[model samples]
Target: MLTAPGSLKAECSNCGATHTPLWRRGLNDKLNCNACGLYCKLHKCLRPKSMRASHGEGRRSGASSLASALSALASVAAPPPSSATPVVEVVSPGVSSAQCYNCHTTATPLWRKDEEGKTVCNACSLYYKLHGSARPISMKSDIIRKRSRHDARAQRSSLTEPPSASNTPGTPSETPSASPGVSRRPRPV
Candidate 1:
């Protein structure tokens, strides 16, 4: 079976999945499939065996999935009118002004609905989902952190490069542990 370059062949101890987009370490440093690892990390328990999918099951190519999502969004955003006359919308007191219910912020990269069907900002929604509690107002910041996406070609090139005589497996290389200008920061709760 074809696999991602630079990825080692390993079976997940939890789900017995041999193919995964990314491999992660789980309990006792055992290798785990991507889905199992993320689920275990979030819930602090093993993923249910029933959730495991068979080979080549429920997999959609990125391009096709993205196209379908865009088309669906377009259809929902602008539906064909039944008549030539334009529809007029009346503002109601019960209607929200697209502001986050939790943080009351009008600006957000994306909007999401909470468990109560209340509108919330992307950060607030994700934070609540992970923590199982409303995000603290004190933690809200005006600045949205920007993350740099590394080029896949550059990473592949680095991994595919041949080992030099001085940089053999036994000998330590002079390169830094992390790539230049990249900083790993802890996720804020």
Candidate 2:
């Protein structure tokens, strides 16, 4: 009858015979069958535990001891599932999406992108002269439209002014000449 040390039944797959399973000390020595003449493949019974425990440098022989060590190591190493608190990311409303011009931080309010694809914040834009010589900053659509309108008004006023009358040949001299008054006689003598 294939039985473990404490009445545990062990069956041999090869011979269809049952025998008492011995406490496996190591590979190649776990079971002995008198009827079919087969020795227990200790690997079948004890190799898995040995493999788990033998991952360390030290060798462990008994299956029970290896299993115990593995269980203890798992308990020590594995982290418990946490249910304490949930993490959340907060975004503020009405804030500028542009980051700081000098620093790449997302904190600055007046972030603008230049034609060269540089993102400058208000502080950086004000301090650094990237507009005059360098490429102009890309403004928001609403701001661009407002600036266009203002420029159009200025152009229209400039065009409406007539050319100066001084350009004509018959134009009178604007400089005033002294009249033939009585003031030229030697100060009433």
Candidate 3:
């Protein structure tokens, strides 16, 4: 049971048992496990509010969420009864038989096992046939594809482009070619 106000239950660091929860002292940061009489070593950061795999180091346990850790500390009751079935009426459909692997839709009129041996629904199968790629993100974006194509063209051009002394960087060309087919000539005298 949590004793201090705003204090949460913490598992015994030594025995790793939730039944023997300990209260942490703010000043010295010591764990007071009354059940096991386990006291955290007096150090700057021996044991933080968050539990860790090892004494002070190793991966931070329950780093994903403190709520999850708290939930784990809470006592869980027994699960409810089973045998809850959903009722559905099949309309003027073909003999609904196969169980889909992907969607898990039972009594599917038409279902087939995928290469990996998962049930695939009829509509899903048709959709997959029309548009490949399981996850949309798995397929390269159109913008990315276009950009890659442009980059490939640029790379080929760069490789094929002969080295020239005129177009060198830092050293500006004598005159900027004003327009195509119009050469820079001396002004009319």
Model with the higher lDDT, candidate 1 or 3: 1
Off by over 4 Å in 1: 1-96, 151-189
Better of 1 and 3 by TM-score: 1
Regions of model 2 farther than 4 Å from truth = 1-89, 103-118, 122-189
Candidate 1 clash pair list = none
Worst 10 residues of 2 by lDDT: 50-59
How far residue 59's Cα lies from its native spot in candidate 2, in Å, is 54
Q: TM-score for candidate 2, please give it.
A: 0.19
Candidate 3, run of 10 with poorest lDDT: 137-146
lDDT of 1 by residue, 35-130 (tens): 788988999888765465444222345676456546645655756777986676777875545888998887778899998998999999999999
Candidate No. with top TM-score:
1
lDDT of 2 by residue, 1-189 (tens): 235456456543333335323323223443433322222342344223322332222233467656766775676674665787544455687754555444555655457775577786554465456445432334322221223888889899999987767646655545444774334324454
lDDT of 3: 0.49
Candidate closest to the true structure, highest lDDT:
1
